[model samples]
Target: MNNQQWTGWSSGAQQAEQHYLVEPRYLAGGGNLHHVADFLRASGWSDKSKTGGPLVFDSPDKSVRIGYDPYTQPGGWTISANPADGQEAWHATFTRQTPVEIVAGFTDALTRPRSAHAPNAWGPLQEQRWQTEQGQHFTAMSPDGGAWLQYHQSQPGQALWWAGARNEHGRIWDASFTASTPMHLIESFSAALADPQQVMRPRGHVPPSTRIRTTSVSVRPDELSAWQQARVTAARAATWARASWATTRPRHTTATGPHTQAGGRTRR
Candidate 1:
């Protein structure tokens, strides 16, 4: 953790004073999409988009496809996976307004090898002492009362899990996860929501008209929160690697594969 303190607005903070704490990405609508894109590219996903069309990347084994389109209706980013070895396929879509960090949670988990044990979705929030209503249909609210997540056991074919943020004015943002969406992805998202690390935002840009009043802290113009700094560092590394690869690799390298959709989970 960076000991150097800086000021920013936080709905999750205990007071309107300077401290390190991560604000929910749903509270405001800004994040760097390039960071996640570069991460996927660096991890061996092959680009499959046309020069002027929406960006598309396919996993090396062609089991997954990720897409980003500014103008796509309903959602601008999408991920679809279909494994050939009888594993379930899953699809997820994110609205253009969905914060990149939230989406990155899923992508980050996706790239990692599957864990030997099943993931527990509620554990992350529980660790933070979030309030929960236990039942067939489960729900939990953040300690600050600004964000919440729920599981609709009865709504099997529908979106089984839904999460959102709100303030005095109204709902700021929301997302849903389908039944087929992997549990690990849901767990990763919950972990991100519960992460204690703080995000850096300009004082003037404080967001969502919070239910819990926020305090301001001082930050140097050149300083950035740890999360922000990590994204910047990843983007820089990806860019430098691409430039180096272009200069060193032969121009004739080519890849080709067929894309197929099979049975799996659906998410939104």
Candidate 2:
């Protein structure tokens, strides 16, 4: 399942290592962070870290946060076979197990009857990965028209996904390289699992809708000055244009362009 070739381990090119590439997905979050936490508990992981992160599984061989968290390791989730914590079997433990298991198990749970509510109906339409003063994150939308899911890569192998109310409510799992196969899967998941009504689906089925408009935003009058408002309006227009372009463009885009999500919040 993993195609790892060691063509440049010491050539100052690509570092060679054995890893099971994880596929990212936009999942239905009816129960919020607690839902994701349940997955970790079921998987035999522990959220014992005082770092205010997701649950983790630690052993004699490895130490990895069960889900992904970008805070500690940017660019991806925190997956270290040779952790600095003195875990000797980092390679041995991770060698036999891949991070995909966590993703797969979590996604599988989303398919359950009470999880998504109705049939799958939301997923990633297009994603823009960029960096800001705060950190590196992504802006994802649903192809079928629903909500916006914004996420960030905190660490090398971990990511945190939330809506415009990302931190307002619970968290979701959303991460993967911008150009990887997992990216495609994630896009599909966003479209299939994104709930527009902000209500849990019935039997995990997302409701159908022809009301396909860009998500709306709510800004308090006192939050920005007149000039800032004008700039923000222009930025919103540009973001719409880019999203439109994304529909016809490639599935994965590498743009160092500036992000337009004010305060990193996604509207329903």
Candidate 3:
């Protein structure tokens, strides 16, 4: 298909195009993963390319290119492509977030590594896990969706690694990797936590909240009788009494009467 008219391709076409072009799919939106994938493929973008190449499309103003790179230690793919001459460029990345379960699994797998350093050398793997954790959080709250947000925020020409996990509430979370340290990953996580749907918002529109209330009623005669009986029993158990001495004393006692004390002595 011609590059200019390439956007018309469907999801199946896009998938086929990615196979033909060898480009990795990332940050797909508008429910058009395949279409976009096909477009990238027609332009010669792929996960294996170090630098993108130029391409021709139906529109003279449009130009496209794709590039790929490997991240350090924990291996991952970073793909970037753009339509420079067009109105805008599309770009995305695909990185695995090592889920907490996966991390534990990996750690267990390394327990009997062939080399002595293999067990202790899990730094790269650990970093990958951290990156996934950070990335997941970042993506969850990214203002422009996870893939695009991470791509735009990422340092040019670098892959972002991360670990993945399901939060306590069963939500997917990830940590990301960047240059120098994992601080950026932490920042992404914080941002994600603050606004989990940051990137998924409809251009300027906020999501509405949903609330639910439940009520239960019983109308059986037996249930009603039981309830009435319980109420009656409770009422009967409750009592009030005046704190006057005459009330606690014998019925013959009067307000002015003296009480008998110990040893049968009468006290006034």
Candidate 4:
């Protein structure tokens, strides 16, 4: 291990605040970890150097140089990014937002300007407990399909780590690493009290209210029941009400009452 202190990025010694292009952590291959590198390869950039150099992702203009070397760290890799040339060369670490954050950080670095828009504070949308090659794994995603987080353990009640990813639309994405968490398969169910399916689910038939329609209430004259009479009267009233509502657009109106039958009997 290089005993040299890795003081990430500091503006100055007085009130020095360290910033990182990509925060370094114990290598945990997360996200499409090599996406940036893949982009480089597609751009006709080759990783084959005559002198066997560190893995590097450089912009076409050769401004941004993100280099990673596994031998630099004792049990991991060292990822660093800087500009090859320019007065603003010192702005190497300004990419604090889109820094490569996986155990696969020995990967690519992007130079796209970070979005000025604020990131959404995500709440869990979906969860699944499944078995993986390693052990039992759990995963959760956001409702918008914009973020994903996962956890895995070696055995039934063993420890695990979190790996996460968030994206800005389809372009830039981020990974997650939460340390100092003591959760079992799921130690405590203490949660924020929280928290595609293009399949069309069958819904009960709903009669449209705003849409005017004709409803036939057929009944035999000799065997008319109170309910049948009520339906026939209601159908006629509805027809009239719809006409009145459509033509006059009445501000206030009462639904006309049902007719009363003979012998002081009310039509139900």
Question: TM-score winner among the candidates?
Answer: 1
lDDT against the true structure, each candidate: 0.68, 0.34, 0.27, 0.31
Error of 3 at 106 (Å): 27
Q: Which ranges of candidate 4 are over 4 A from the true structure?
A: 1-36, 43-53, 75-268
Better of 1 and 3 by TM-score: 1
lDDT for each residue of candidate 3 in 181-245, tens digit (9 for 90 to 100): 22322333333222222121111221111211111221333433353455334322331122244
lDDT of 1 by residue, 146-189 (tens): 78889977754654678877777876666777677789888998
State TM-scores per candidate. Answer: 0.67, 0.25, 0.18, 0.24
Ranking by TM-score: 1, 2, 4, 3
Which residue segments of model 3 deviate by more than 4 Å? 1-75, 98-268
Ranking by lDDT: 1, 2, 4, 3
Model 2: lDDT of residue 69: 45
Could you give candidate 4's per-residue lDDT for residues 119-217 as a string of tens digits?
222222223221122226555544433334455555666533443333432322233222222121012111210121111001121121222122222
* Residue 146 shift from truth in candidate 3, angstroms: 14
TM-score of candidate 1 to 2 decimals = 0.67
Candidate 3 displacement at residue 45 in angstroms = 5.8
lDDT of 4: 0.31
* Residue 25 C-alpha lDDT in model 1: 49
| Model 2 agreement with the true structure over 32-136: per-residue lDDT tens digits | 233334444443344555567544444222343334443543322333333353323221111111123323333423222133333221222332221112337
Report lDDT (Cα) of residue 220, candidate 4: 28
Output the worst ten-in-a-row residue range by lDDT, candidate 1: 13-22
